[model samples]
Target chain A: MQWSTLIVFLLLFVLVTVLGFVAAHWRKADLNQLHEWGLGGRRFGTWVTWFLLGGDVYTAYTFIAVPALVFGAGALGFFAVPYTIIAYPIVFAVLPRLWYVAHKHNYVTGADFVRGRYDSPLLGLLVAITGILATMPYIALQLVGMEVVISALGFPMSGWAADLPLLTAFVILAAFTYTSGLRAPALIAIIKDSLVYITVIATVVIIPMQLGGFGKIFAAVPPAKVLLAAPVGQSLGMYSAFATLALGSALALFIYPHVLTGVLSAKNARTLTRNMAFLPAYTLVLGLLALLGFMALAAGVDKVPQYAPFFKQYANSFAVPALLMHSFPGWFVGVGFAAIVIGALVPAAIMSIAASNLWTRSIYRAYINPRCTEAQEASQAKLASLVVKFGALVFVLALPATYAIQFQLLGGIWIIQILPALVFGLYTRWFHRYALALGWLAGMTAGTAIAAHLKFAGSIYPLHVFGYAIPGYAALYSLILNIAVAAALTVLLRLLGVAGGQDQTTPGDYRAAVPDRDSGAGDGQMAAPPTL
Target chain B: MTTRQSSSGIHPRLWWRLLLLVPIIATLWVPWYNHLNPTFIGIPFLYWYLLMWVPLSAVCSAVVYFKTRDLV
Candidate 1:
C-alpha cells in the first residue's frame, strides 16, 4: 500500500478534471449550438487537432493492451504497428475529403454525410446506428483500461469495492463531458499525450538498460513467438493474420465516429494533412510501447506479487501495469497509471460526443423531429452524450470485460462495412443506394458470424478461408465478401434501371481549398435538395 | 456528383495513383519477408520490415498530397 502512489494518482486526476471543466470556456464557442458543442466549433487548429486526434485514436487500450498482447503472444502484438502505419496513409487521403465535404455541408456525423450524399434517411440511419454500435464497446474498453490501472494501484479486488472506484471515475468524467462537450477532450488530450510520451520513453530506455538490452529481451521470449510463427511455405500461420489484421484495422480506423469527430473538428483540410505527416510519430511511440511487452516479459511481470494471483487466473492484459508498478518508484508508477486513466477520459469524451452527434443529426433531426431547431439539436446531443457514456458504463460495470473486448473485436469488422457507402460516396456517387445498404448488411452479418464462430475470443480469432487457416484478423476476410456482394448487387441494380438518389454535394465541394468559412453556428438544414 | 475530372492544377494523377500503390503492395501481403535473419538495430526482419513501412508510407502520402493538393 504505497500511499505516495495513491496520492500522486489522485492529484493528477484532480488536475485533469479541472482542465476538463475549464475546457468548456477554452475555445469560447457558443455552447447552445450543436456544431460548437459536438465539434468544438469545427475549427481546431493544427497542434490542437493533432493532440485531439492523437488522443482520440491512441486509447488507454494502446498503452494497456498492445504490450499485453505482445507479452502474451510475443510477435503477434507487433501487428498494431503495421495497422497504424497503413492507417495514416489512408488518413492522409480520406480525412481531407471528409473534412472538406463535412465542412462545406456543415455535416456533424458520418451518417449526416451519407444522408447528404444519398438523400436517403434509412441509409443515414444505418450509418448512424453502425457508428453508435461501434463506439459503445470502444468506450467500454476505455473503462476497462482505467479499471486495470486502478486495480494495479492497490484498490480492493472483485465485488462492489472495485466497481465503486470505476463508477466514481465515470461519474466525474460524465459531468465534465456533459458540460464541456468536444472541447473537454481536445484540451485534456495535450496533458494525456505528454504524459504518455514521457512514460513510454522513460520506460523503454530505462527498462532495457535494467534488463540488458533488446538482445536479451528477445532472448527472454520463446524463440518461436519471437519471430512470427510462419510455418514452412505458409505465411497464413502468422503473416496472413498479421497482414489481414493491419489492413482491416487501417480501413476501420477512420470510419469510427470518434476519429471522424476529431477530424471534422479541424479548421481546414491543411490541418489534416499536416497532422497526418507527423501523427506517425505516435505510431513510432506505439512501437516502443509494444516493446514494453518484451520488457514486461524480461521483468518477470507476470510473477509480480500482487498481480501473480490475478494473471494466474485471467489474461495477460495486466502485464504492462504490473511491469510499471514493479520497476518504477511509487510516484512514477502513479504517473504511469494516471497517464493511462486520464488517457481514457480524452477518448471517452470524444467518443460520447461523436456518438451523440450521430444521434442528434442523423437520427433525431433526420427522422424523429425533422423540424427541430439548432438549439434543440444541441440540447438533444447533450442528453445523448450522457446516455452514450452511461451505456458504456453499464457495459463495463455489469458485463465481463471479455465481452466488451469481444464486442470491440466485431467493432473493427462491423464498422468497415460502412466504408463503401461513406468513403466511396466521397469520390463518386455511382453505387446504387440499395446495393450499398445490402453490402453493409452482408458485411455485418458475414464478418460477425465468421469472427464469432471461431473460438479465439478477445483479439485473435483463427479464420478458415477456402483451404488455408488464417490465425487471426477475421475482418479482412469478411471485407472481401462485403465488397463482392455490393459490387455484384450494384451491377445487377444498374441493369435493372434502378436509379440512385440525388447527391447533395457538388464537384467544387470535394476540392474546396478553403471551405466557405461558415461561422458554422446555427447552420441550416440539408443543402437545398441538390438543385437537380 | 460532378462527373468532371480533376482539372490540371494537380500533378499527373497517375504518379499519385502509383505512389499510393507502394504501401498497399508493401504491407498488404507481408509473408515473403517474414524472417529473423536481417535484424534492423536489434529488431527482427518480421517486426522491423513492417515498422519501416510507417515512415515509408508517410513519405509516399506526403508526395501524393503535395502533388494533388491543388487539383481542381
Candidate 2:
C-alpha cells in the first residue's frame, strides 16, 4: 500500500466533501422549492453548465471503461470519440428547445414536459418510471467505478470490510447531496473537471515521453488492434457496429435523466446552445483518454508481475488503473485516482437528484398528493434522493458488478425509447399520446428481450434484412421499431377520428429566452405565464 | 395559435443550421476515413481523422450558434 497515494486521495476527498456542503449556500436560494433544490434555480451560466454537463456525461465509469474497451477490443472502442463529437451538434439542435419550453412552464423533469405537452399524466408517469428505471443502474455503475479506484488504492476487498470505505464515501455523498441538492454537483464539477484535465494531460504528455513516442506506441500495438476490421461476406461487420454505436449513443446521451438535469439547469436557452458549441472540448479529452489503452499495450503493463494479478481479475477494466500505477509515482497516483472517484461522485449525485425529481414531481405530486405544497415537494425530493442513492448502494454491494453492467446496457436501450415522447413532442403535437405510450411499451419489451437473448453479453445484435446482415446497436434498432409503431398507430388513430391530447405549450414557448436579456420583450412576454 | 405565426416563423439564417449536419455525415460515413495510410505522427488515419472532427464539429456548431443566436 502506498501511503502517499492514500493520503492525497483522502485529502482531495475531504476537500470535495467540504465543498459539497458549502455549495448549499453557494447560490443562496430557498431550498424549499423543487426547482431550487433540483435544478439549481436555473441560474447556471455558460461555464458552469459546461462543467456540469461535462461532469455528468463523461462519467468515471466512462474514464475507466472506454480505455479498457480500447485496450481489449482496439479500434472499435474509439467509437466513443465520434459519439461525443456528433452528440454536441445534436444537442445544439435539439436541447435548446427543450430548455426553453422547460423553463417557461416550470417543468422540473422530462416527464414534467411530457405531462405538460401531451396533457396526459399517464404518459408522464411512463416517462417518469422509465427515467427512474434507467437511472438506477447508472448510479450503480458509478459505484462500480468508485469500487475500482478504491480497490486500486489498496482498500480491503473481502467480507464486510471490503465495502466499508465505499459505504462511508457514499454516506457522505448522500448527506451533501440531500442537503445541498443540485448545486453540490454543479459546484464540485468545476473542481472535478480541473483535476481530470490535469491528470489526463499529464498522463498523455508524460507517459508518451516515458515510452519513447506515439510512433513507437502505435508500432508496438498489433496491426489488427490498430484499425477496425474490414467488412466480411454479407456482413458490414465491425464498421456497422461502430457507426451505429456512435450514432445511437450520441442520441441516447442527452436523453439520460442526469444529462437533462444538467441541460435544464442552464440559465437560459442561449446558454445551452452556446454550451453545445464548446462541450466538444471534453470529447477531445475523452479521445486522448481512449488512446491510453493502446499506450498500456505499448508499455506492456500486463507483463509486469504486480499488475498481472489485477489484469487477471478485472480483465480490460483494470487497464487505466494499471496503466496509471505503472506510469506515475505514488503521489500522482493518488491525484489521478481521486479524479476518477470524484468523477464518479459528480455523476452519481446528479443522477440521484434527477431520479428524485422525477419521483417527486411526476409521481408523488401528480398522484400521491395532488395538492402538495412547494416545500413538501422539495422535502420529498430530498428524501427520495437519499432513497435512490441507498438503492444504488445496495445494488452494487449485494449483486455482482456484472448485473449492474447488464442493467446499464438495458438502461441505455430503455431510456432512448422516451426520445419519441420527449424530443418529438417538442416540435409537433401530431403524435397521439396513447400512440407514444404504446410505442414506448413496444420498444421497452423488444429491447429487453433482445438484450436478454444476447444474455446481456453484448449490445450489438445481428439484424438480417434482404439477404444482408447488419449488426448494429440494439438501442437504435429498437428505437426505429418504436418510431415506426408510433407513426403507424398515429395514422390509424387519426383515421378513426380520435382526438389528440392537448398541448399546453405554444410554439413561442420553444423560442422563449430569459425575459430581461433578449431584445424583444414582446416575444418573451408571450411565453410568460406568471411563473406557475 | 395566433402567437405561433409570430414565433415559429423560420429564421432567415436557419439555413446555417444545415452546417451542423456536416460533422454528422462526415463521421457517420465510416468507410471514407477507415484506412491506416497517411498516418500523422505515427497515429493511424482512422484515429486522428475522428479526433479532427472533434474540433471541427465544435467549429460548425459555433458558427451556427453565432449565425442563429437571435432565434433562441
Candidate 3:
C-alpha cells in the first residue's frame, strides 16, 4: 500500500464517519419520528437540497462508470449529459406537484404516494417491493465503485482478506445511517460535492495543460470515437439509441426511490422547483467528466507500466483512478479517491434509507402492523435500513460485480415500469387501479424478456417496426407497451363498469401554497385554502 | 375544495410553463446537433453543442420557475 495515500484516505474516511454520526443532532429533531429520520424532517432549504440531490443523483458509480463507458464506447456514453440536462425541465414541470402532494399527506416513498393515490394497498406494496428490488443491486453497485477506489489504493483485491476493509467501511456506514438516517447523507453530501468540484476542476485544467491542450487530446482519440456515426440507412442505429437512452433515463431518473426521497425531503414545492432550475450545474460538471475518458485515452493510461496491472484487472473502469494516480500527488490522490468513496457512501446511505422507508411505510405498517406508533415506525425503518445495507453488502461480497451490474440494468427496467402508475397518477387518476397493476406486470415481464433475449448484455433492444430496424432503450419500449396496456384496459374496465379506486388526495393538494411567514403553520402543515 | 379547476387542463396563466419542454424536445432530437464541424476550443461540435445546452436548459427552467412562482 502507498503509505501517504492510504494515510490521507483514512483520515478523510474517518472525518466523514464522524460527520455522519454527528449529523443526527445537526438539525435538532426527535429522532424517533419517521419523517425526521427518513426525510430530514422535510426541512432542507434550497442549498442543502441542492447538495443532497446532487450527491444522490450523480453517484460514485456514475463518476467511475460514465467516463469508463465513454472511454470504451465513445460518444454514446455522453448520453449522461443530455439525460441529466433533460431531467431538470421535467422535474420542474412534474416533481413540484409530487412534492406538494407528498408534503400534504406526509408521504415518505413513491409507493406511499401510489398507495394513497389509487386507494390500493396492493399496488402500494407492488411499488414498494419493486423499489426495494431495483435499489438493492444499485446499492451493491456503489460497493463495486468503492471496491474500485479501495483496491486502487493498493488494498487486497481478492480473498476474505480483501473484503475486510469493505466490510468495515459498510459497518460504519450502517451505524451512521442507523443513528442519523437521512441527515447523515444530507450533511455529508456537502463535503462530497465540494471535493468533487475540486477534483473535476483540477483534473480538467491540469490534465489538459499537461497533455499539450484540448486540441491534442481530441486529436489523439480515434476518428470513430470523436463523433457518433451517422445512420447509414433506415435503422437510425446509434442515433436512436443515443436519443432514447437520454429520454428514457431522464424520465426514470426522478422516479427512483432515492431521488424521490431527495425531492420529498425539500421544505416545500418552491424549494423543489427552484432546485430544478439550478441542479443542472451538476450536469455541466458531469459533461466535463465524461470528456476525461478521451483524456485518459490520449494519455495512454493503459500502456503505462505502473497502471497496466489495474487496467488488466478493471479494464475501462480503471481509467479515472489510473489517471489520478498517474497525474496527482499521493496526498491529492487521497483527496480525490476520498471524494469518490465518500460519494459512494452518500448515495448508498440514501438508497438504503429510501428502501427502508418503502418497507416501514408501505409494507410493514400497511400490512403487518396497522396500529404501530410513530416511534415504532421510526425504529422499524432504522432497523430496516440496516437490513437493506447488509443485504447489499452480502450481494457484493458473495457475487461477481457483473451480477450486480446485470441486476442494476434490470433494476432500471423494473423501476421504470411503475412510471405509468406513479407519474401519470400525479396528473390524473383516470387509470383504473387494477389496470395500472396489470400494465406494470406487462411492462416488467416484457422488459425482462427483452433484456434476457439480449442475454442481459445491454439495455438497448433492436425493434423491427414494419421491417425498419429501430434500436432504442428497452425501458422506453416497454414503457410504451405499459401505457398502451394501461389505457386500453382502463377503457375496457370503464366499459365493464368496474370501480376505479378513490383518490385520497384532492386537487388543492397538488397546488398547496406556503403559509404566510407569521401564520405559525409549519413547513409541511397545510395552509388555509385559497378560494378557487 | 372547488372542482372548477380541472386536472386535465393547464391554466392559461401557466401556459408559459410549456417552454420547459423546449429543451427536452431539442435534446432528444439527436440528429439536429450530431455534427463534427464548427468546433469550439477544439472540442467537437456534437460534444460542445450538448454541453452548451446544459446551462441553457437551466435558464429555460429558471424562466419557467419565475413565471409560474405566484401561480402554483
Candidate 4:
C-alpha cells in the first residue's frame, strides 16, 4: 500500500480538511450558540487547553491498545505508564476543584454539575444517561482506531473502500462538527498533537534503530512476551490490568462526558488549571507509545494474524502501523499513517461533541422542550452533532472490530458510574436525589450484569473477577462493582427517610465564578438555580 | 475564590520525594531483586527499564510544574 505512502496519506487528508472548515472562523464567536455549538466558546487557551487535553487523553485506543497490552503482556503495559504518572497528581488535586465548580455554576453538563450540585433533575438525568451510555462506546472506539488504520491500508474487505470509510469518516466528521463546535476538535487538536509527537518520538528512535539496538531488541523478545512476564497469568495479569488500567484510567480521566466537554472548554480557571499541570507532557508521549509494544514484539511485525486468546494474538493492534512498517522509510510510512489518521480524527471530533452535548442538553432540554431557545439550543446542538456522527457511523457499520475494542474498555467501565453522581455532587450536598436515582439504577444494573458476565464467560477466555482472571480488561472490575452499588444505594436511601429533592445548589453555589452571577440566562440575573 | 495565583516560575518542589527513587530503582531494574547480582550498566535486569523511565519522567514532569505553578 505504498504509492509514496498513498501520496503522504492523501496530503495529510487534505490538510485535515482545511483545518476542519477553518475551525468555524477559529472561535471568533457568535456561532448561534450551545455555548458556541457545545463548548468551544467557553474559549480555550493554555496552549489550546494543552492541545485540547492532549488530544483528549492520548487516544486512538492509546495508539492501539497500549501497544497491544505491551505486545501481548510483559511489564504490564507499563500500567499506562504509571497510571499516566499518577494522573497528573490526580488532575492537580481534583481538577482545579472541578474547574472552580464548573466555572462558578454556569455548569454545562457533568449533568449540568450534577443537576446544580444535588438539587437534582433526577441527578441531572443520571449524569445525562451516564453520559450517553459512556459516550457511545467512546465514539465507537474512535471508529476502532480508524478500523486499525483501514485494516492496515489493505482496505478491501469487500467494496466501496471497505463499506465506505466509516461512512466517509462520518460525513467529514459531521461537516466540521456542524461548522466548528468545540472548535472543530479543538482546531484539529493542533494537527492532532503535532502528528502524535512526530509519530511517538519517531517510533521510539526509529524502531530501536531498525531492530538491532536496545540489546538486539531485548534479545529477540519472547521472555514469554514481556509486560513483565512469568505466569502471574503472564506478568501479574498484565500488572493488575495495567495497574487497574493506570489507576482506573487516572481516576476516570476527568470523569468523561467528553472530559467534561474538554474541561468546560477552558479559557479561565487558570487555563483549566494550567492544562491540568501540563498534562504529564502527554504522559511522556504515552510512555513512548507503550514502548511500541517492545518494538512490536521485537519486529516480528505480524500486524495481526496471531490470535490465541490474550485478546486474540496481539501485535498491539498494528502497534503504530507495525512500527511504521518496521521502522520508517517507505516515505516515512506516509508520515506515520498521517499520524495515525490524524489520530483517528482527534477523538472522532471530541466524541461527537461529547455525544451531541448529551442530546442537546440532556435529552432535548430535559424531556424535549422546556421552551427550548438559545437559537433552539443552538439548532439542537447542531443537529445533535450530526446525530452523534451517525451514531458513531452505526458503530462503524454494525460492530465487530472486536466489538469496537470491547467498547472502549467498556467505556472506561461504564463512565466510572458517573463518579458518584458527578464527582460526588461536586463535594457533597449529601447524595439522596432519590438515592442518586436509586444509585444510578443499581449501578447501571450491577455494571451491566458484571459487564455481560465478563463478556460471555464461556470457559472464560478474557473474563473473571472474584477468583480473578481478566483480559479484555473487565470494565475496570465492573466499575468496582459500579461504585459499590452507587455508594451502597446512596447510604441506604439516606437512612430510610426516603430522600426528597429541591436543594438545587447552595454552598454559596460552589463559590461562584462570576460571568455575571450564574449566567443560566433568564435575564433577571441571579435567578440561575432550578433544574427540577 | 480569586486571589489564588501560585506558580512560582521555575517551580520544582519535592514531588512526592520522587517516590524515593522508585524502590531504589525498582530494586535495581525490576526482575524483582535481579537474580543474584545481575548486570546494571552492561544492562539486563529487564534492560534497566529503558534507563529507569528517563529520570523518573523528568521528576514527574517537574512535580507537575511545581505543584501547579502558583495555580492561577
TM-score of 2: 0.94
Candidate 3 off by > 4 Å: A394-408, A513-532, B1-10
Each prediction's DockQ against the real complex: 0.35, 0.51, 0.48, 0.03
- CA-lDDT, candidates in order: 0.79, 0.86, 0.85, 0.64
> Candidate 4 residues A32-118, lDDT tens each?
878777887776778887787778777776787666666665455556666665655555445556766677667777887777666
Candidate 4, number of clashes: 19
Q: Which candidate is the best by lDDT?
A: 2
- As for model 3, its CA RMSD to the true structure in angstroms is 3.8
Q: Could you list the CA RMSD of all candidates, in the order they appear?
A: 5.2, 4.0, 3.8, 22.0
**C-alpha lDDT of residue B25 in model 3:** 84
Residue by residue across B1-72, what tens digits does model 1's lDDT show?
212223323334535647766776787666666788688666678777777777887788778766655542
Arrange candidates, best lDDT first: 2, 3, 1, 4
Worst 10 residues of 1 chain A by lDDT: A523-532
Candidate 2 residue lDDT tens string, A1-532: 5999999999999999999999999979999999999999988999999999998888865678788778888998898898989998988899988988887888889999999999999999999999988887778878878877888888766788988888888898999999999999999998899999999999999999999988999999999988888789898888998999899888888888889999999988889899888898999999999999999999998888987766665567778888999999999999999999999999999999999999999999999999999999999999999888877766565544332234456668989999999999988898998899999999999988898788766788999999889999999999999999999999999999987877888766787544443556445444433210
Runs with alpha carbons beyond 4 Å of true place in candidate 1: A231-235, A312-314, A397-407, A455-466, A513-532, B1-14, B66-72
Q: Candidate 4, residue A254: CA error in Å? A: 16
Candidate 4 achieves a global lDDT of: 0.64
Which of the two candidates, 2 or 3, achieves a greater lDDT against the reference? 2
Candidate 2's iRMSD = 6.8
Per-residue C-alpha lDDT of model 1 across residues A113-140, encoded as one tens digit per residue: 8988988888899999999887887898
**TM-scores for the candidates:** 0.91, 0.94, 0.94, 0.36
Q: Which 10-residue span in candidate 4 chain A carries the lowest summed lDDT?
A: A306-315
At residue B53, give the lDDT of candidate 2. Answer: 95
True contacts kept of each: 0.39, 0.70, 0.64, 0.03
